[model samples]
Target: MSASSIPGRLRRMNKTQKLSVAGISAVAAAALSLSLVPGNADAETEPQAISGAPVIFASAAGASQAKTIQSSVIEQHSTAEQLIKASDSAKAKAVSKEKAKKAKAKAHAKEKAKAKKAASKRGKQGASRSESRTPVFSNNLDGWIKESLSIMKAKGIPGTYDGLHRNIIRESSGNPKAINDWDVNAVNGVPSKGLLQIIKPTFDAYHVGGTPHDQYDPVANITASANYAADKYGSIDNVNSAY
Candidate 1:
């Protein structure tokens, strides 16, 4: 079936018969080329369409990775929040502890101040008691005599101003420093000293409780002499001797 002989064969046939011959020749040419052409071997071997499972698996893996990343971020944020809360709690505890310490210190200081004030008050009360018991005015001779008289009165010793003055004039001429150095008392190593001219041993043996210990002191000498006179002669006014 060459293409050059097909036109010659159609020229010998009638109109209707030529149409049938041309149709059959067209069919025969198509059939001859079908056997001579190569088949689609590579296309038949290759897959026609893709499956849905691989695309679905890829989408799931992407979603899981995104979820993991989001969870990591959320965990980190939660940890940070926990740390902040813990820090704040520690700070609050520390502040409370400091305030408590300050309050305790304040209470301790107040207690100490109260104790000091109470001690001071007790000392003042003691001083008041002492002043009421012994009402001494001045440190002079007259003041000392008056103060000693108060003590003597409390002890029930009897004496008068006239008797004490009369004896002082006769003994020392009112000189508080008068001494009998050439007398028998001086020879016996017990000198007569002060206003009343009393010996050292007699003055000491009859020393008044609230008077000065020195025999040369005027009030001390007068007080000791009066006390001795009260015990022996019963009163200072009855003493007419060198005693």
Candidate 2:
């Protein structure tokens, strides 16, 4: 029963009724006390009814009820506070994880940018090298003659740049594709061809290894003619006519 209702109800009741109500109140207070006790399962296991004559509740009863209510309120508040703290912790972890992810992504992007810059730098260097590089030689009669002389020097074949150039100018006017179709050699079915006007029989006989077989090919014709001259007249500078 409620504490405020007790006085009013007692005023309206006779002694017998008040006695009955007081006894019930005492039992209720006793049960509430037992219920308030923590870890009292064994007490609850064997239920017992309160049996006694009517008695007034002590001031301690009201104090006990107030304390129980205050304790419950305090426990609820503590539970809510704990829940809030736990939620804050979870949020903090999530924020930290997101920050870590963003940091890793930023680092990866930075590395990719650096790698791309390095590759671009290397490509620019490669282009600069290409631009700065020199040609081995031009694909022309003069280039062919100079290249042949180098090969001739390696093989111990005797020839000079000026001597070879003079012979080429006189024989074919330095034309790599020149042909003597009306010469005595041509009359005998061996037409002179190329920069040094080399006939087919002589070109084939003196053709150096590792050179093209086409007598009209400038390098091959000059090298073969030099070889023939070296063997026939001891040097190409000694040959002033068709040999």
Candidate 3:
């Protein structure tokens, strides 16, 4: 069997037994050589047994062992190939998933940027519109009348510059603080006041929105009186008398 066991076995045997085993091994080697010869017809016959040990076909045993080792190696190689295929498939799926994630993030970032840009554009446009619509008026009759007319237009109250001017000139001669303290309205304890000489009750009744409530306020006085005259005489242009 093993080389280490051979020395131990020889040490245990007597001198005659050792000689007998050696002689048997020699005869067995010689017989195997003759069996392998090309012209020997006994090559196919069963080998003769040695006296102290069983006959062994070393070549056939080595070939069968080599075949077993080769089969094991082939099986291991096939297993490794299958493992490699599975690993490659997993890697491919992971790579595809990563690519899709990156694409989705890129699309989301692009949409966010687009929305931010649109919001910025809308803010700029709104600022420009606010600046354009802002009006600056001087503190005078012309400015006051124009401002009141703008408010009147917005409120759907009908009146014209010529009509308002004509009535204001006749009523208080364009003086915003004008007051008729000695008239019948004054005797009644409610004096006619402001650019249109409007009594307190009449002014209160026809007060237009968007103007200050003060009777001395030019725009307020004019718009309120104009609103009253428009309701009664169709327009301020028709009011030429004490009305």
**Global lDDT scores for all candidate models:** 0.80, 0.87, 0.87
Q: After superposition, how far is residue 71 of candidate 3 from its true place, in Å?
A: 6.3
Ranking by TM-score: 3, 2, 1
Error of 3 at 100 (Å): 4.7
Q: Candidate 1 lDDT, tens digit per residue, 102-195? A: 9999999999999999999999999999888866558654565576566667777788777887888899887888999898878988888888
Question: Which regions in candidate 2 have their CA more than 4 angstroms from the true location?
Answer: 1-58, 136-178, 182-185, 188-190, 198-243
Which model is ahead, 1 or 3, in terms of TM-score?
A: 3
Q: What would the per-residue lDDT of candidate 2 be over residues 1-243, giving only the tens digit for each residue? A: 999998897699999888777778777778778777878855654566656644456698899998999999999999999999999999999999999999999999999999999999999999989988833656886788788988898888898888798899999998899999997989999989999988898899999988899998888999999999999889898888766
**Model 1 RMSD, rounded to 1 decimal:** 19.6
C-alpha root-mean-square deviation, candidate 2 = 14.2
**2 versus 3: better TM-score goes to:** 3
Please provide TM-scores, in order, for all candidate models, with all chains considered together.
Answer: 0.44, 0.45, 0.67
- Separately for all candidates shown, the number of backbone clashes (residues 3 or more apart, or on different chains) is 0, 0, 0
User: Cα RMSDs of all predictions?
Assistant: 19.6, 14.2, 9.6
Question: Which pairs clash in the backbone of model 3?
Answer: none
